[model samples]
Target: MTSTTDHTQQPREAEEAREGEGTTGTGPDAGSGAWDDGLIARRAAAASATAGGQPVVPLLPAPHTGTPASGPDGADDDLTARLDALRELTGLSRPRVDAATLAEAGRVLDDAAARRRLSRRHTVVALAGATGSGKSTLFNTLAGVTISDTGVRRPTTSAALACSWTDGAAGLLDRLEIPGRLRRRPVQGPDGPGPLDGLVLIDLPDHDSAAVEHRAQVDRVLAHVDAVIWVVDPEKYGDALLHERYLRPMAGHAEVTFVVLNQVDRLPEDAADQVLDDLRRLLDEDGIALGEHGEPGATVLALSALTGEGVGELRDCLGQLTSERRAAARRIGADLDAAAERLRPAYVPTGRVGLSEEAREEFADRLAEAVGAAAAGQTAERAWRRNAGRACGTPWLRLWRWYEARRTPGTAERPPGGTPGAEATAARQRVEQAVRVVADEAASGLPTPWADAVREAAARGADGLPEALDGLTAPEPAPARPPRPGWWPVAVLAQVSMTLLQVVGGIWLLGQVLGVFTPDLLPPVLLMVAGILGGPCVEYGSRLAARGPARRYGADAERALRDAAAGCGRARVLDPVAAELLRYREVREQYARVLDPVGGDGARGRAGGRHVRVTELSTTGR
Candidate 1:
């Protein structure tokens, strides 16, 4: 059966009156003056009604804003602004305070207020260990009362117990999530050495057991408590589950840890020391500090909770530690350090090569030359005319013209040299070859990836050039409108009549020459002159009829070539360079965001530097 005790101590009426009346002082009375202890206690009780009768707020006052009352509350305002700035920096939609930021806030709170609440200096030491480690006996011995059930039973201490110091250190109990409803008792010494000031000894349930909820409770309260005392007995000293699961994982918190070898009375005196030494060595190997052998690691003490041999020393040690107020800061600092490490990766720079302005300009220039926009347009005009002439006119017609220019009056055959159309065809081919050569040369020096992209873009741009040029150069097949019906036939009939007249005149002249007809025949010279003139007239009219189609074809071809050149320039050259430039801009923006100290929100001052206090709020509880 567990021993239970009731604490009947109550706040004195005179002390309560002093607490109700607010005063400007830096002592315990300050917490009392601003807040009614009874009211706070009642509120805590009401809040904890749903959670297994556990008070959420306990009797602790809210942490005070330790701001100074000078310079128009500048320090208080500054802290508020800084916190707001930090909030903006994180860009968090919810109140997601990291461990580091929480620690920083705690430090700020510590600096801004005086120690008016005795709880500020108090430490909550929880005894946590595996099952069958004799932790119940240790708890009872430490409390100087049989507060927990310790027997030969397989399991003990199902619920937690709170052993408080009589030095009015109830605030620490509240911070640790221990309620006033928990059984409390005072520890006594042979001379009744005054209570272990500001220490709350908590006897927690076995962490490894069938009662999983009991273990969860221990974990939930561990975050709020100051220090932890892990108890282990000789039989379970080298337990793999305990060391691997708890001791090794908490190696970073070497300062506030206390490892005790309990039930040492079961071992021989000489073997007890040896086993204790071995346990310390094992902890050291697992990265836990042990004694002063290394940097002040966790202190190892051999104790028999059953015999109560080391109970006084343990109590004295707990008192001294609680008085120093090291546990809260140490625990908070470790959490903060871990959080800071996690944030480091977010600021690291990713690799990217930077491009210079001169390089970009050079690339642009090369691309401009490759497309040959201006030159291609001019060359296309001449090439289109030559190709159109050969496609529309007959080779024999060209041959006849060449012969007409070279042959003397009575020549029977044409000259050996080819017609003008042949020379024009050759010239057209040369122009196309030149265009290809210039385009290739201009695209030669670009970076491979960009070069490929530009080439692909140019090819897509020029895809329609061939069809556009064909449409532009196609000859109009529709016949020209005849001069009104009657006039067009009359002109054709008149030409036929003239040709018949000439033929008749020629026949008559031949007859006159043979002396078979009268000597008054039409002159052959006149007939010949008429035929020659008529041939030139017909040729000129034909050329006049075809002029519109030829002009239209030439215009269309020129437009097509110009469009193709423009498309190639845009896709192959301009687009790739522009994309590269845009990529550089994106990279630059990302780097700027990482390096920008003020988070780019137009906030005041730099982000990282020595912190300056902005404001001091009234520490008096409202």
Candidate 2:
């Protein structure tokens, strides 16, 4: 039997030895007892960089095994990374995520970290059960001595009792608050050396004790222990408090649990099987997986701790557990799994957040409309045409307009400029509306915390937007009028020539009418008609020639106004929204890393990094 036990344990020990060299010694408890401050800072920096979507090499240490003195590979580094990620995530999602939820996650991390840094050599297994369940008797039976008080008392054990078959468990016992008086070392079994060496078996107070403190003490020990064997009697195997309050909540921790139907010796063989089946059904209802069909799950068996029946099987199971020395790592992994499940919704959203080009273009357009960019462009175009018309019109018309303007001094038309208060108010409202539309689109499908964050970012970016936009619309100082075209002079000269011909023709006609000269009437008549028709034609042709330049001038003004509006929109709204979405994406990816260090799906402890197999520890012992 000893040879067979060693045979079973040697392969695992060899595997652990080979994998032990892979430890990089950068974890929280790496190299020595002292903490690695430099490594902690690097991890913090990496987490900070992750929040900004920056790529960083997270130089985290790998996890060490239960026997840290030997430097085994326990995948402790992944948990540290996850803890850092959680810290970073919580920092980023503050006030958005519920305080209670964050507090729970914090508690889990704190407990796991504390437990991990303590003694890894001893596998602390608690035997927890209700009052008079024979747990104290079982504790003594396993220790091969009367280490715990057990009698007619309703609540046999008030405080925990610890029994170690090996040395180096003082630190662990101290952490458990087990007094020196209650600590013991086991004597040799009938065969010789105890089968369960290196195991720190804790006899916890009755879980359902009438005394509240006893029950509370039971809970405290259960929280810290590496594994638990629930000793239940035949009558109380389906007890509501045991199944409801403890077993169901700890369903994820099946790998570290053993449900023993103690006191089964009182039942007949056939009846015992029926009772065991019923107990299995109850555990299944509590969501605890059973290791019955060669699967990795909780171990369930019949054992009469008082009669010594089936006690050997239980010892064999525990011996396998202690020999493997992975109980601490397994329990920590299960704790991490529970914490990650609670935090999943906050970190992992339905889909990713993104900002598309179409949304950007639309936002810009809206902003331009809010500022009346197109209207300004049209006004500029018309102004250019009117100015050109005045510059290129006939001299006679110019003289008439000048005389009229002098008569009505204040009636001259002004350029399209000057933003009114009412118009600015309307424009401000439009700008705000445009901002809301884009912010909503960017935040869609994100969780409440991240969506809230995106909105806050947009708000901050747009805080001074309306004022900035108001400044953009303020009329620019009138520029020096552009130099006129050389053709203006030629057109003016042609008009002047037409006026001279008309003047000379009129004088000749007058002379003929007065009978002072007998010039040919047909020549004078022809000259008069040509001068009259030619002057108007030249003015009309000039107006038409200026149309192309006037249109281009208008287009340039429109483009400038729209471009200015678009730039303001991009600065105030688009950029910030895009940035928020990017941050969410990066943080979300970091969250994925926390959930699975290998950067994929499944429970963090099971799917990623080097971790104790859930079924391997529990099922192997059975």
Candidate 3:
């Protein structure tokens, strides 16, 4: 390695020599202003000896940003609480989201918990970049020691190397899985204290490594770090893989990010400036923030680890950041935001879903038909009429009806409705169809899982309903035999009188024939005619009275069937479906709580310290 002093002094010597003489000398010191191999080696050696056991020189000064060092604060406590709440709430949403998504979020929560528990005192920051990006060199230079090996190997930084400026970070490093040998304590120069007092710096493997394990390692650690420094060299500054793969996806992590164009000393002064501007443009296109005039988005720095060009400026920025010590919270907050965004779809609004009246009524109608309720009701009406006729009609007619009832098939025997045949089959089909309709209706506005559950519930309800329906026999006294009217007895007496009148008429006629008359023959004949006519009128009145009871009987039977169908529908279909819907409602409400921003007064600012709100999901399930 060429020392900075030697390389810079060579150019100065040339300018002086050229000004002093018209001809330049071709020697080791002034040959085209390039240092010879011997001179470079000697300078390197002299520099090492000149250190005199002293620590590396400090160029960057502490920033005056007044950001506090990492310490216990109510804000962090509140943020942790909010994070716990978020994790718990997400668990409740397990039924709605896929297993993969839930597992991923669970990992995030677990990592956050572990990191928080390990050490909130040390802000873990990592330097990550593509191969040959000078990230390892920068890390070693930052620590002012050779902890991570640097070389021309394809991937020099194989494993993560950590450097901590403060104590109590050993536990944290162990958790990161960084071996103790690769860990180093930063040089605390004679300047009393450095700006990165409680900082823990890491050099991670190249992000786009050909080796899968290397890339996996990068991903694993990136999730746990408090902040990141993206080291990009001049040659690969505009690489889309860098921006598209890592930078763009981490848009929410801008506040805790630094985009440094490492090895900028390789380029000329003007070229370096152009590269910086162009890189910022690329980052902008990548949606990685470039804070307004370096306020606090992605702080861009142009630094050279070998020459220490912009290292001081980067140190100053990081110094301010470390002083504030909000990177851990900011990083964790950004992660939670990402998780919430990913979970957005499950909570999409669909409003409310339920069974419509028309659907329920249709379902009941189908079941009613399946069970032959209508036929049974009509049968009941006929049975009532027969019974009423027997109780209130003339004795001769009653005897004839009794004989007829005995001959009738299935009279108060099996199912009141004759049999389960074509009508029953058709009814069963209709019942199944009705179940589908009700299920579809109830599931209309619900999410996919809930809708399926409702349909299942409806099917279950239909399955057990057929037999229950067919077995419903109309309630007994299976007949509606009304009491005999008072007029019935009077009619009986009148009939007797009529019979007597007829007998008298016959006797008188006979007497007349025999030449002896007891009463007038005309009067006896008139009486007989009246008695016969009145008897028919009384019997007709009794028949009319029986009609009302018969109709009521039919109604009662139909009602009983309906009650049975409704009970089946509720137990099998409605109740189960309702339970599923209620579960959905409960989860939806939990998601609603998830949607609400954790309204802590000062415990948490917006993620990235930008005034941004998470997109709240509508409850309508659109």
For lDDT, the strongest prediction is 2
When summed lDDT is taken over every stretch of 10 residues in candidate 3, the lowest stretch is: 14-23
**Global local distance difference test of model 1:** 0.49
Candidate 3, superposed: residue stretches over 4 Å from native: 1-98, 145-153, 191-193, 263-297, 301-313, 344-351, 356-358, 381-424, 456-463, 471-553, 597-618
Taking every candidate in turn, the Cα RMSD to the unseen true structure, in Å, is: 21.2, 8.2, 20.6
Superposition TM-score, candidate 1 onto the true structure: 0.44
For candidate 2, the 10 contiguous residues with the lowest summed lDDT are: 1-10
lDDT of 1 by residue, 394-460 (tens): 3345568668857756664332335746744543443344334333433344323333433454445
User: Deviation in angstroms for 10 in model 3?
Assistant: 50
**242, model 1: CA deviation in Å?**
1.9
Q: Cα lDDT of all candidates, in order?
A: 0.49, 0.70, 0.64
Model 3 residue 47 lDDT?
38
Off by over 4 Å in 1: 1-64, 68-118, 167-177, 188-195, 291-294, 343-622
Q: Model 2 off-target regions past 4 Å?
A: 1-77, 91-99, 189-195, 412-419, 483-552, 600-622
TM-scores of all models?
0.44, 0.80, 0.70
Candidate 2 residue-wise lDDT, 1-622, digit = tens: 0011111111222112211112233222234632322333444456566545766645433443343244244354445555555545555444456787677666665566566666566789999998878998899998889989999978878899899888888888887888999898877757654557689999988888899999878888888888899999999999998887888787767767889999988999999999999999998777776766665567898989989999999999999888777777666556655665666566555554566678788888888898788888877877777676677666678889999999989986664556677777888899888889888877776777778878888888788888887788787776577536768778778888887888888899989999997967987777888888888898899888877877787788888878998898887777777666655554565455555454423333242122322222112210
Best by TM-score: 2
Query: Which residue pairs clash in candidate 3?
Result: 67-323, 348-621, 349-619, 349-620, 349-621, 349-622, 350-620, 350-621, 351-620
